[model samples]
Target: MPRVVFLLVPRVHLLDVAGPAQVFSTADDLGHPYTLTYVAEEPEVATVQGLVLRTETAWPSLAPDDLIVVPGWRGPTRPASAGTLRRLRDHHASGGTVAGVCAGADALGRAGLLDGRRCTTHHTVQDELARLHPRAEVVKDALYVEDDRIVTSAGVAGGIDAALHLVAARHGPRAAGEAARAMLVHMHRDGTAEQVSPLLRWRSHVDETVHRLQDLIETRFAERLPLRLLAEATGCSERTVTRLFSRATGLTPLAYQTALRLERAGHLLERGATAETAARAVGFEDARALRRLRARPGRTMHSKEASWTQAHP
Candidate 1:
């Protein structure tokens, strides 16, 4: 069993702590055997939401597989104690993974973990984090960033995405997908996907039918999904589905599916897959279609052969 130790700070955001905790806890319920522990400077810590939380003062023994998460807090950031900072540094030095959420990245910076590594935080604090840690590469407008073994995320709910990513890294995407479904998270965003990814861009509406249609298309993007099949799945007429999807997401059902396919193909290509393999894997009939998509203006491939590369690499 791997232990997930949460280092709670004063005035911590409730969701930042609860969201990721729920992910690991649910993974445990799903037979992943993750043990969660909460530790703070004192026995009791007050939250920014005015709720007080109890914690253990002593740090537990940790192994490389164990994770240490620092949940962000509210108000002006304060530096942690030298001893606490040392513990963070020592843990990663011993091959453990350390993560920072929102303003909690300050703690990682203070511990020298972010130096020479790529990281991110709440947009409001991006410049401040960069100024504080000049050696760190601060990525703006990203949901999260994982460089080497250190992970950092943007503000608030971004912690859930980052934690889900960690779950996927540890137990595979299937486990992470199950955990996300259990939490009612409709979509699981990849770390490489920016804050405004196509996967999440059109999800800000309240149309359940559109959402369902998108979910179906996203899950089976590689299959040939006819408009009639999509309409039937969502219990709407083909014309209604088209209008609703277009009105909500600014794209037709087929266009949305094509976007998903292209995005996945980009990732596959970035990982060194040949264009033919990527096209087949992402449901494209051949590399020619993928090449045409890439050749279109503003549709660059994400691999080294193209313009954009992996954020970590």
Candidate 2:
């Protein structure tokens, strides 16, 4: 089993810790032999979300294949004890992997792990990180980075993208895709991709109703889902459902469905499916309709084989 240890700081960002931890937990639920634990500088540290977290102050034994992560905290950087910093350095020096989310990278920097390593932090503090660690190569606008045994990510929900990338690198893209889909994440940001993917444009809502609608659209992209069916399923009037869907996803229900169909068709085409066959597979009326759909902006697709293990280096 691979062990993952998350080191916490005072007033830590809840999502920063929860996002990545949930990824491993989800993977473990799916039958991956993953062991997760939490350690902190204090026995009980307050979180930014108004909850106090009890943590193990003592260090845990870990094998070289195990992972250690530092999750970001709430305010300005507060220096941790030298003994704590030394543990981070010692773990990586012993061939274990270490990672950070957002300001957590500061902890790695203070531990001297960022020196000469490619890394990133939240966009708001990129300059500060660069100035503080002149020797570290601070990458900008990237969701995450990995150099040798060190991994780092941008802030907030960037933890999910970074964690998914780690899962992909270790298991396979299929496993990562399964985790994303299970968590209702619609897009998988690449390590070298911009912090935000265009596929996720205008998606900044947390309403369960809109989420349920999108989930249905994603699972049944190839079907003809009328607006009334969606509205009724969401238990709202058609006007209200349409307004909310547009507000939440920035696309009309039909537009969202079209995007989904085109996306699915792109996957089929990459797998050597003919245009007619792919169009039929994804609810397009014909090959001509699929061709016209593909003519839209950013509709070009790359055909990657189903074999996820060979997709990346």
Candidate 3:
């Protein structure tokens, strides 16, 4: 079983700790073996939310596959104790993965782990993080960044996305998707804020009708789903469904379905599936439709896909 350890500090933000912790806990509930541990410099730590949390003062034995995460705290950055910094550096040197959320990146920087590493933090502190650690390449407008074995997130809800990304990387997209669904997290952004998963994109609104239609379309993207069936599912007229969906997601129902199919087809292609096989599996009539979509302007491969291609080619 992989162990996930969270190192808490004074005035730690509750959501920064809970969000990622919940993701891993949900994954564990879904049969992914994960042991979560919490540690702090003292036996008790106070949160910015005014809650006192109890934690272990002694560190646990960790392996290469285990993860250590530092949740951000409130106020200015404070340097960690020498012993704590040593533990973080030694764990990473032993090949364990380390993550810093929001202001937690400051901890990693003080330990010199961010030197030459690409990292991100809450947008409010991005400039300060860059100024403090000149050697670290601080990424802006990114939900999270992973370099070497170091993961840094923008903090708050962005920690959930980073945790989901880590889950997808460790397990698979299916597992991550399952966890997200269980948590009602229908939106999933990639590393950059501008890019997101097709299945999870355009879902930031609170329109119940549109959400109902999206749920239906996502589950049946590989099947023939006409506008009438979608409208009937939401008890709305075809025109209303079309109008609401377009307004909420900025894409027509058909366009949304097409994006899902195209994304699935891209994944299949990356896994060595032939064009015909992928197209048929993703509801394309044939390879021609898939080819057209792939060849269309502004339909270029995502950064993750491009990286896969470069490695495999």
CA lDDT, every prediction? 0.86, 0.81, 0.86
Worst 10 residues of 3 by lDDT: 304-313
Task: Give TM-scores for every candidate, taking all chains together and pairing residue i with residue i.
Answer: 0.67, 0.65, 0.64
Q: Please, what are the lDDT tens digits per residue for candidate 1 over residues 49-158?
A: 99999999999999999999999998874747899999999999999999999998999999999999999998788999999999999998888999989999996889
lDDT of 3 by residue, 190-230 (tens): 67652356666678889999999989989988887777899
Off by over 4 Å in 1: 196-313
Question: By summed lDDT, which 10 consecutive residues of candidate 1 come out lowest?
Answer: 304-313
Task: Please write out the lDDT profile of model 2 over residues 96-179, one tens digit for every residue.
Answer: 999999999999999999999999988788999999999999998778999997999996889998998888888998888788
Ten consecutive residues with minimal summed lDDT in candidate 2?
304-313
Ranking by TM-score: 1, 2, 3
lDDT of 2 at 221: 74
